[model samples]
Each structure stands twice: as structure tokens, then as C-alpha cells.
Target: MGDGRGGGGGNRPAWLQLYDLVGKIGEGTYGLVFLARPKQRKGCIAIKKFKQSKDGDGVSPTAIREIMLLREINHENVVKLVNVHINHADMSLYLAFDYAEHDLYEIIRHHREKLNHPINQYTVKSLLWQLLNGLNYLHSNWIIHRDLKPSNILVMGDGEEHGVVKIADFGLARIYQAPLKPLFENGVVVTIWYRAPELLLGAKHYTSAVDMWAVGCIFAELLTLKPLFQGVEVKATPNPFQLDQLDKIFKVLGHPTPEKWPTLVNLPFWQTDLQHIQGHKYDNAGLHSYVHLPQKSPAYDLLSKMLEYDPRKRISAAQALEHEYFRLDPLPGRNALVTSQPGEKAVNYPARPVDTTTDFEGTASVQQPMSANAIPGGVTAQSMAGPRPGPRQISMVGMQRMPVGSMAAFNIPSQAGMNLNPGGIPMQRGPAGQAHPQQLRRKDPAMGMQNPGYPQQKRRF
Candidate 1:
């Protein structure tokens, strides 16, 4: 493909003509993520290149869903979909997003391994608050971000929006307000470490509470620089359940009881596999032993509510924002990097590294791009094939674009036709061509970290 500058008879795909591919930043199950420079624009853009769909269709449903949902919602805390493009050559799909330089995963890793100091209280509080704020918007719109791990939470770097948190990677997100099928039929969702207890046990029905559970786990990680639950995922087709994961949770939070969680007995695994799950009886709560916050502290109180046993009782994102935790001194700020306290110094977060090598080159013979109606925001590739038109506008009619954007377990009744992972892999977290798990490094919280009692993380999900 020729650079956007009109070389090679200007036969390059329209997407290539609009954005100059800088280099590949990350690769995942979907495809590859490239750092792009809009030929006519000043700032950078992260272009996600999706591979051909399984059926060799025009675009994958995941990409379409992301584009449709992003176009409908407009919030500073939410990652914006600048534009959608197609490489006519292979019929591959590409999504353009406002580049965010930092993510909570990288930031937490940096503070732990590089600086060797805990993140300031102000920064942690601010980051959490912004995360909840964005989550509140999604919940209000009936969108449940099934995947809310630390890596998916992006932080802006070196811009007017620097230090601001942007909730990203919506491939696994789903609109829970109404669904044609049971939410569980979609299969496993959240990453294992951050997964809610109800999901592990196979609850057949669920709600927005699943997301709040993930937020709680993220909050714990921000405080400790390590995944709160580091259980090894069983790779077999289906055995009992996520025994190690449930054990890990039970070890810390104590086993669930029907009294505390009214619907506990209704879960399929609880009724049928109770013997296997109840290997170790835990009667007392030991969460405080790992997290050092005072029991009476607002932060601890909020965390407890978020990690509540019952999904029905788990704290909502909106309620979490108004909790006493944010009401305390050193309140959250818009820019998480900037300290909210009067005299604290802002932590200088390093910029994300970009790879200059490995640019994307399409393989299929060039073909006319798909119709504009199929693409999000009513933008077509053919319209971009012509000469450069003024300064490039990545997001045209951004907010006005399109309309805006589960659980349960149980049953020993019959295992036939369940949405079990026959391959035994965790659910695909993000889009194929988007970022993958390259930066996901396992750390031992027992070594010079806050949660020394917890076991070492052996593998990266």
C-alpha cells in the first residue's frame, strides 16, 4: 500500500491514503493495532485493523458492535471512535480511535517495578472515580462492559486531556437492558482474575452487578499493584467449575452462605457440585489481611460493598461515585496524574512506547470498498479515495452519529448444550486486530508488595 502522500499511482486503499501507518503497537486475537498519523491532522490515532471474519464476511460482528456503540455515546471518560475504514483489498475492517498514551495496567506496573513506590493515594482515588463515572454512563445507557480489567482502562498522555481516564476495549461489552437470549448463552466474559464469583459458579442470569465486581477487583489491584485473585485457570473442557478461582476468592472473602446471598442455592453448580466447591470451609472474612486499609475507612467500606457476595446487592457505579471514599480529603480530580491534595507533587507517568518497525500491508487484490451504510458514522471508503480534502477530520458528526448502545449459573439438570469453552480458553477479551496480552506480565505480590500472603501469579491470561 502506498503512503497517503500519493505514490505508486495513488492506487492505495482509501484508509491508507487518509492515515499514514506509523508502526504496529500491539497484536491480539483479532488482528494488529497500528499507531497512525492522520495525513492532514496533527495528533496521533490508534487504528485497529481487524482480520477477515471467520465466514470471510465483510466485517466481524464485534467490530460492528464496537463502532455502533461508540458512535451513540459521547463522554470524556469514554474512548471515542474517530472513524471507521475498510481495506478493500482483503475486506478487512479498521477502527480509528483517539490514541491514549497510558493505561492503568501499564501505570500500575510502572509504579511497582520502575519507581518501586506505591501510587499516591490521590492518583488511585482519582483514577477509580473516573472509571466509575464512565461506568455509570454505560450502566445508565444499559451497556454492560463485560470486560473491565486494568489493561482495558486507558489513560491519556501528553495532551489537553492528559491524565484523564478513558474506558476502552468494548468488544466484550453488551447491552443488558434487553436481550433476545439469556446473557449466559454468550459464554464466559470477564478475565478470570477479575471475574465475579457468580460467574465462576455458573449463575444462569446476571445483571450490571457483574461489572461492579470487576471494578472492585481493579480497585484492589490499584492499591496493591497485583491481581487480587491469581488462580490458575483449568484448561480442561469442563470439570466441576473454576475450582481454583473460587477457592482463591473463598480464601480471602470467605465462602458464600445462603443467608448472605439469597440466590446462592439457585445456582446450578451450588446445588449439584456443592461437595467439590465446599472443600475448604471459610467462616470469617479475611479480606482485611490482604488489603491494609482500616475497616472503618471509607475506601475499605466501598471496596467491601463492590465485592459483595450477592449480585443484587453489589454497589452500582453511580452509588460508588457518591460514596464516602470520594468525599474524603484528597478528592478525585479530572486528571488522575495530577495530585488533588494541596501540596502533593504530580507523578510523571512515562509515555507509551511505539514500534517503528512492522507496518501493515494488505494482501488481497484491491477492490472497491463496501458501502457507507454498512460503516459506522455514515462514512465510506470511496469518499476517502480521492485527493486530500482540507485538514483531515477524524470524527465528523461524532456525537450526532448513531443511536447509543449478564449472568446466571446453575444447573446440574443437564450439561448438554451449555456454552462451555470446549477449547478451554478464556473468552476472547477484545477484537482480533486490536491490542493483545503482550504487556500482561505476572508479578508476585508476596515479594515486596502489599499483599505478601497471596500466592505468586504464575501465568498471564
Candidate 2:
């Protein structure tokens, strides 16, 4: 393979020749992410390298699904799939995407730990607005981002699209237009901390409301620099219903009842596991206590709607963008870093750190390739060890946790909103770069070079 500096890489894959593998960004159960600079183009790119199928057959179903879904859609708020390449020698898959400098996870950590202050109100509002805007686009098209969390939400660094929110990591995203099978049959979805109540209660049939619940949790995390509902996960085999996660939510929002959620009685777990689920009683409704927002504040009202107990009543992304909260002072702008208020300095968040030690070639050689099983949401067998830099960038693929929050009383219906149909747009790629091969090596043991259990399989809608 040709080194990134324009050498003889004619024998390698097209990607290895087109871009210089600068460094390894992060790794998960399925693959590793590399940060590369195009030899001919002026900008950088994030190349996700999927491990060869365990059976060495074809591409992993998750990768195939992501490619299919991403290829069919295009929006500024959504992450762009630049290109896809396959290494026939190993049957590995490589997906190239426009490089995003920072994710919500690091941005939040910077504010909480390094800067020692909460993210500015303007930034928060703008971030949330863009999030809903992008989500509305997806929901309108019948797509549900099964995994929506801070780590997967990318914010571009200094560039033409700086501070623009791009919803990345579509490995768990799905089109919810009448599926071939129940979504639950594929097993758990969403990170544990951002999971929906319906999922925790074991609802077999679900909708885009699950995404809205995650957005609500993200909104709360933006307001309060911590996970609104920080419940530890129970990582048992076959994924048992998360009792701790549900209890954590009930303590804050009060337990759900048949009156509040009419369809609550229909859930599989609610019917079969009623004793344990109802073992403890909670009656206090106190969202006001944690959020500290005034009773009638637009922010509070909008949040309450998003976290509604009944998934059917959960605020749709389209409806949320029109909520009074977004209409209040400091109106949302395209760039989240800049405050709308005059005389306010743009918040300069630190850029995402890149590990240059391990490039694509380096990673492939050291790591043991194993096919990800049919499990969906769980932490990797090993987390990146020695951390000596900025916020760690781990893929939140197939992780689970229900969205957490206390709720104030509000009336709701028994059904969710309707999906909108929008015309599809073709993808536009940046100018192509010249070919270069780079031989890189990795010395980090904690980078998760070995693939563990398989994540969930992809299902067609």
C-alpha cells in the first residue's frame, strides 16, 4: 500500500490510495474509525473500517443497512456518507464520511470539566433546535434513529459548516414504515441512558416516539451537564428488561398507570412481569425540582411534552421545532457555537483529539477480526485503556438505557403523530483527492483491536 505521502499504493484498496490514513479516531465491536486527510482535496475525512464478517462471507448486515439507508437520504443536519469501499482481500468494508471535529459528548465534557461552566444558553438552544430539525427530516421520511445520544451527534469544527449539528452513527438507525418483523425481535435498541420507556416496558411495536424520548434526554443533558437519568445497566444474556432503569425513571416522574398510558396494559413485560415492575410505588411528580425552570417556562413545557409517559403523546420532532421554547428569546441559529446575544463571544470548544499512532494498516494487522453476533446494545467487552488526552470518542453502537426524567402533569392522547413524506435528494461529494498509501502501525492495547460478540442484525422496513 502506498503511504499517505503519495507513494506506490497501486495494489491497495482505492481508499488507501486516495487518502492518507492520518490516525485512528476510535473503535467499537464492529470496526475502527480513522481520521484521514485527502491527498488532493483540502479537507479531512472520517473513514469507518468494518471488520470482515466472522464467517468471511460478505459485508455485515449492520454495515449494509447503514449504507442502504444513508445512500437513500441527504440533509445538512444528517451525516453525509461520502463513499464506500471494499477490500476484497479481507472482505473488509470502508465507509468514508465528511470529517466532523467534535461530538456532543466531548463538547459537554469540555464545558463541564475543562471550562468549569455549563454550555451557554444560546449554544444549547441552537444545538437542540438543529437536532429537532434533523430529526424532523428523518421522522418525516419514516426513519427512526434507534440510537440517539451525545456521542453519535457530531458538531463540525472551524470550517464552512462549523457548529452545525450532524446526526452520525447510523448503524442502529431504521426505517419504521411497516417493518418486515417487529422491531423488538431484533433485540434492544438505543443506549441504556437514552432508551425510551416503551422499550424498557418491552413494547414489541414502536414508532419514532422512541427517538423523541432520546432527544428529550439529550435536551436535559444539555441543560444539566449530567445524564438526566443515570441508571447502571444490567448486562445479562438475552437482555433482561431493565428494572433499575425503569425504577430510576419512575422515582423522578412517578410510576406510570393505566390512566396515564392507556396502552400500558398491552406491553408484554407489563403484563408478564407486573409484580416486579409494580413492587415499588412512587407518587411524587417533580420535574420542577431537577430542571429548576419556572412552572410555565417554554423550555419546561416543551421538555415535559417530549418526555410524556405515553409514547403516543410524546412530542414529535416537527411539533417540537414549533414549540414555544424555540420561539423565545435567543432564537436558534445555524451555528451553535455563536451566541445570538450581542457582545457575546463565540464559545471556542476544543477540537476532537486524534491518535496518530495507529492508522488503517496498523489497526487491521494487530486486531483480531470477529463477526459481531446478534446482540444490539451493550458496552464493548473492553473500553479504551490509557486515556491521556481530550474527551474519549467511543462509538455508542448497540448500547442501551432508557431516557431519564421527572415529569410535571400534562394531558396526552393515545397515539403518536403522523410521518411526513419528503422528496429524496441526491448526495453531493466534495472534490476528489489523489491516491496515496500509508503503512501505519498501532501500539495501543486499549483500542479494542479484537471484535467481541455480534451486535444486532439489520431489518428492512
Candidate 3:
């Protein structure tokens, strides 16, 4: 199964050769995603190849978990797993999917420098509609997209103006077969920026509402073009009123109390040991503070409801779709608005042909040095060793070399110089690693300087 070049590890089954791999589309901890074309089909497809461990364990459990969940779920807004391929020799697994143009993160980055024509309100509504629709489908199926963010949403077919948006990456999604429990012992489930307050408060039993909180944050970011609640420090601290962002939310929406948020005091972090800081309001604020605010319109109201402090009070994804925001003139539609941005055009490319070699042989290529930034915590890795249970950690080297489609499947960041290597492995260091905290602290240029409602936390899968 191994190509003489050490490229193909004979990890892919013979039947999988029916599809031609064009090139690397993305890379992740466990696998490489490639732009592939089925020999019999006309359009392109995304082929995710999970690196197999030398031992019996083929694909990482994290990948298996994602495949298992994605297989059973189908919705227009959700990315579909077209097929799976298993290679017996190396225990590798390949997942095929419909190809997409770009992820929301890429779109945001492309438009970061431009302010006048930023994603219009209509476009935001359409994307939000699709996101909520996908979430609704997942929640209805008793699944939770623990990680929901711009990076995870892939733009397909040509969104309303440019291409359609599809919710991708279900690696962290879990089924709600029983009452909710602490999925992670350390309360480190979601990403920092889009994480919900309840998660930070250590609430063991939660619901789909957690996803709504993230959606709210994303909506605000869409309007403001920056993360709503990126805390100053990595280590959690009780800075109740210091963050001007949250204070602005209270100023516009009013403060919340135990009565307003009944479970606020019951959260794991809200015990008597947790200090109760008095509320504060923003005074003498300038126009710059609220310039990005959506006109006092229905979209604004729905955004407010989604960002509600009380998870119970949050609007359901289905309910949010029915809101008037989506009914506005030039109704939000599927497909992205096209532009002349670099890498935006859909290119017609040929697929990479499969090698006709018969025997599986190991090549002598030297393993590349690991990247300085390892895969983040919670990401699973594919081991060359025996099968390990639960989630495995993907290595940084594996990620950089991973195929494009696989990278999309795993929601890896697309920044050119960012070190996506997992586990802090210091093979290659990039500007992202050298970026100062202050540089990271700058607000998302797309969202601008205006504080929009609650600061959204990152939702990790």
C-alpha cells in the first residue's frame, strides 16, 4: 500500500483508488484532506485521509467519533461525509465529502482590511440562518456541536452572493442519550473566545443552549468584526467590570440578577466562595463605542436574545430563524457574495492519479521536524503505535502535511504563518508563535471597534 515515495502508506483501500486525489486541501492532527475527484463524477470532492498507526489502531478515536456522528446526521446546513475508506495494512481511514470554497474564517480574513463593503447585514443573516438551521438539526438529533465558530463553517457551492455556508467539524460533538455530565473533567471543553459562561462556571449538566451562546457571540462578531469576549489573560480571573466590552452589554441590555438568571448562582463557580461583584455601567460613551451596532432592528433584537445571559432564556436555533431579521428585504439567501479576493475563484484543476504500485513498502524520507506550536489541547492525534482509546492528540507535523479537505473537516486555522502544530512541539515556529499578546489583543478588524453585546468565547470541539 505504500507508494515508493513514502507518500501513500497503502493506508487507503483498493476501492478508494476509484477516486483521484488532486492535492492537499488541508491538514489536521489525525489526517490530511485532499481535493479529490471521483473517476466517474464530474465535480471535485474532499477526501480526508486519517493517518493510520503502525499498530492495529487504524484511525484515531476522535476521527472515529466524528465519522460515527456525521454518518447518522444529514442536513442542508451540515457538511456531509460522502464515504469512508479503510486501509488494512496501516489502519488508515479515508472520508470523502463535497468540496467547499472556503471557511468563514478565511472570508473574514480576506475582508479584514476593507471596511465599507464588509459582509452586509443581509449576508450575516443568511449565514446565521444556515448556522442555526444546522444547529437545530443537530440538537434535534440529540447531538451537540460543542465547537461552533466562523472557522468551522464552510462556504460551499457559491453562498447567496458568493457561496453557501455549511456547518463543518463535528469532532467535539456528542450525543445526548442521557442526562448531561461533565464531558471534560477540567472544564476545558469549548475554546476561549466563544466559550459560554456556564462552561466557565463549570456547569456539568448543560444543553444545546450552550451552542446558542456561541452563535450569539458569532453574530456579534459578524456585526462588529471582532471577538466579543476575548479575555485579557489565559488563566481565568474575576474581572467582572473591568472588561469594557461586557460592561457595554449591560449598559445597552441592562444588568442581570439571580432573578433574571436563576441558575447564575447555582453554577459551579458561583458558590459562596465566588465573590459577588457589584454591577457597573458605561457612562459618557462616544459614538465610536456603538458605531457597529445594527440599527435598532429585528436582527438586533434576535442577536440580543441569542446573547441572553440566561441559557434557558436563549432563543432556539429554529426560533431564531423565524425571527424578522431573516425576513428583511433582499432576504438572506444561501451562497456567498462573490468577490475578486485571492483564492476566491473556483479553479478547474485535474485530480492526482493513484499510483499503480502493488506492494506496500516503507520509504526512506526523513520525518520532518515537529512544528513549534503543537495541536491545541482536546484535539486527538493519530498514533503510529497501537490503538489507543478515547481522543488522541494530532501532532503539528501531521497537521501541516495534512490534505486540505481533512483540514476543513477538523476546522484547522488557515492563517499563512500560524503554527497549527499541536502539543507545543517545536519543530517549526511562525509569526503566530511570535505574535505578542497585545497583537492578539487587537479586535477583529471585520467587527471593528464597536462593542457588540456579550463578548463571545471560542467553542472548542
Candidate 4:
């Protein structure tokens, strides 16, 4: 395999060489994302190719974690992962995802440049509602998107008049079933600007509330068209520490003493940063500096709760979704949430049909080789490890074969006795090693796929 630096390699991996490179979309410390069209897929999609080294340290495990989490998460508000392609020759891996035209960060940046009115309340509320819905789904599935920022919140169209918001970029996400070990003992997560106080204070056993903190910061930025906490720059003039903006928050929302936030004094990093300050009276006199809203507005209150210093007291994503702030009149009713636009149709991807005679239920099966055209350059077939199977083929009795790509729609029922395939994909089964005949039927295209037109349902505000 060739090292990924500068794209130098003897022979480009089959997958990389197969897709016609259009142009770069975004770049980060990890890798370059490109706007490309897959040979099999109809529309243009964003393909993130992570850099890898011959020794394997450049690409982080976070990338694999994102792929694993996304495959099981079937939510409209979350970005969709089309497929993953690994190039063993170059040690590079590619993640193909649905493409969004714009992100919340660009929208805010553009709004700032115009000096025009920032995002209006209706739009902000709508976006916030979608964000909470996405988070709700993630938390329900025991997944935590540690990195939540404007840059990760993608918008599908133009504005509130037509655009839809969806959460993307799960590079820093993890399945949070149990308490995380100490950051010092393992790894520190979350982006700095949106990091929760609990994380900054080095709290190890935290909950999903940490993500809500980032949501609060993102909401504040959308309203003010500026970062909530622009960290102190080291090279600034009148001494860097002297110009610290920690109090900017306190000034807007009244100072939180040990009485208001009892946990603040106990945080590991609080004394060094906030204890010595004197006469630091918070200035909540005017609301104009924070968001262009009355102090008593419901949105304002919700934002405050989201940004609460105490993680224990923070509002949950599920609770926030039901808040009155998002229930404004003139929107659809709660039960009538629009999953798809009125007339939009679902797109079906081409897939090869699998033989139903094979014991795919309760046992792992070797994945069939992807079509040469489906994969660009050809890929070598890899078998997953699993329990040994007794060598015997049952007579073709009552077996059914479904059309290609038809079974992609239905989700396996929770009560179904399913086994993880060697490849980690789930396969459903019946009693005594007998494959369920019902699984062979074609499923409706709309069953499991997200609607492409409107990425998520508009909140019934």
C-alpha cells in the first residue's frame, strides 16, 4: 500500500481511480472531502477519503467509528452514508455520503458579510427543532455526537423558504451506553468552542447533555452572527489573559455564583480560571448583546437551559423537542410532522440480488463481490470470521428470491432473532437454523431510506 501523503502511490487504489474526481469540497486535518459522482449512484455525493500511512496511524479510529454508527442509524435528520470503500494498496479509506449544498457555518458567515438581518426567529427555531430531533434519535440509539458545530450542521437548500437542515460529520461521535473513563486516562473529545463546561472541567462520567451545550453555542451564534466564546488570542495587545472573554457570557446572562451553579466550584479547572476574579458583576441589563430577542422569550429561555453550567440540570434533547419555543403557531401539528414533501418520490439504488437458499439467517454469510461497475476498480473479496457451520445443504424447499435492491427497504424487527454477519451486518433468522421465508420478499423503497428532497421533517412550530 502507498502512503497517502501528497497522493503519492505506485498504482492508485481501484476505488480512488474509479471515481472521476470533480473538485475538492472541504478539507480538514484528517482528510480531503470531494464532490464526486459514483459510477453506480445517480446524483453527486460527497466522498471523504482519509489519509493513511504504510504503518497505519494517520487515519484515526474515529473514521471507522463514524461509519459503524451511521450504518445502523436510519434517521432523516442525520446524514446518510452510501457506502465505504477501503483501498488496501494505498491504505486509504473512502466514505460516500449524501451531498448537501450548504452548511450552517457558511450561512452564518454569509449573513455576517452582508450586515443584513441575521437568521430570523422562524428559521432559527426550525433549524433548532430539526437539530433536537436528530439528537433525540441519536440518544435513543445510545450514540453521542461529541462534535456538534455549525460546520457540521448542513443545510439542503436556500433558506427557511425552502431549505432543510440535517446533522452531519460524526467523526467524533461514540456509542455512549456507559460512563466514559477519565479524559486523561483515555482521550479528550469535542471541539473547543462548543465544548461543555463539564468536559472542560475534566468530568469523566458525563451524559448526552454535553452535546446540548454545543447546540446552545450554535444557537447563540446563529442568533448573534458571531461566536459565543471567541477564546483569547495569545498575540493580542493589552496582555492576552487580561482580554479573556469568559465573562462575556456572564455579562449577558447574569453571573452564576456557587449558589446558582453549585458544581462550578468543584470543577477541576474552575479555580484556576474563574475563582480569583472580583467584582465580576454580570450585566444582563440589555438583551441586544446576546440575541436580538426579549430576555423572557421562550427561545431565549430554552437556549439558557441548554447552556447551563451544571450538566445534571441541562435540558435533554427529547425534552427540548417538546419545548413551547418550537410550538409557535402557523406550523404543522405535532402528529402531522412532514417526513417527506407532498409529492417527492424515493430513489432506488441498483443492487444485486442474493440467493435465498443460503443460510443467511442466524449465521454469517460471505458477502458477494461488489459488481465491478458498482465499485469502480475491482475489489478483492474478504470473508468475515464466524462460528463454524455444519457442512450440509438443505433441499430447496419453500425458498423465495426477492428482486435486487428490494429488501433494502425493510428494517429488521427488534424482536427478531438476528445474528451479526461476519462483516458486522445484521441478518434475521427463524428457529432451528431455518431461514425466514418472509425475509425474501421485496420491501417498499420508502421503508428504510431517508427522503432525499427534504432531509428532515419540518418541526410543527
What lDDT would each prediction earn against the true structure?
A: 0.66, 0.66, 0.53, 0.54
Per-residue accuracy of model 1 over 95-139 as CA lDDT, tens digit each: 777677777888899999898888988789888987887787677
- Worst lDDT 10-window in candidate 4: 379-388
Task: State which candidate has the highest TM-score.
Answer: 2
lDDT of 4 by residue, 1-461 (tens): 12222243234444554454434456665676755455664545677766663345433455655555665555546776665665433345567676655567766776777545566455666677767776776675556788898988875532131244567888777765542443234346666677776665556467778899899999899888988876543334222232244455555556656777787777554555554343456556544446766768887888888888777788877777767776654332222223234473322112212221111011223334233234432111110011111111112222222232222222222222221122433222224333323222212221121111212344442
lDDT, candidate 2, 1-461, per-residue tens: 34633234565555477776555677876789876656777666777888766665655767766766776545557877766666555556677777767778888888888888888887888889878877776676567889999988887765566677888888888766555567887688899989999998888889889999999899988988888888888878565778889888887788889999999999888888868776668876687677777868888899888889999888887677767777666667767886656796767665444555566755333333322121111111111111011111122222122121100111112122111011121334222221112212122221121111111211110
* Candidate 3 lDDT over residue span 161-276, tens digit each: 23556777776777654423456432455555677666655576787788898898888777767766665434554322223333444454455568989988776555533343
Judge candidate 1 against the unseen true structure and give its global Cα lDDT, from 0 to 1: 0.66
Candidate 3 yields a Cα-based lDDT of 0.53
Question: lDDT score, residue 160, model 1?
Answer: 69
Model 2: weakest 10-residue lDDT segment is 378-387
What's the best-to-worst order under TM-score?
2, 1, 4, 3
What RMSD does each model have against the real structure? Answer: 14.9, 16.1, 15.8, 14.8
lDDT of 2: 0.66
TM-score (all chains, Cα) for each model: 0.76, 0.77, 0.63, 0.65
TM-score of 4: 0.65
Off by over 4 Å in 4: 1-11, 53-59, 158-162, 179-186, 233-245, 271-289, 330-461
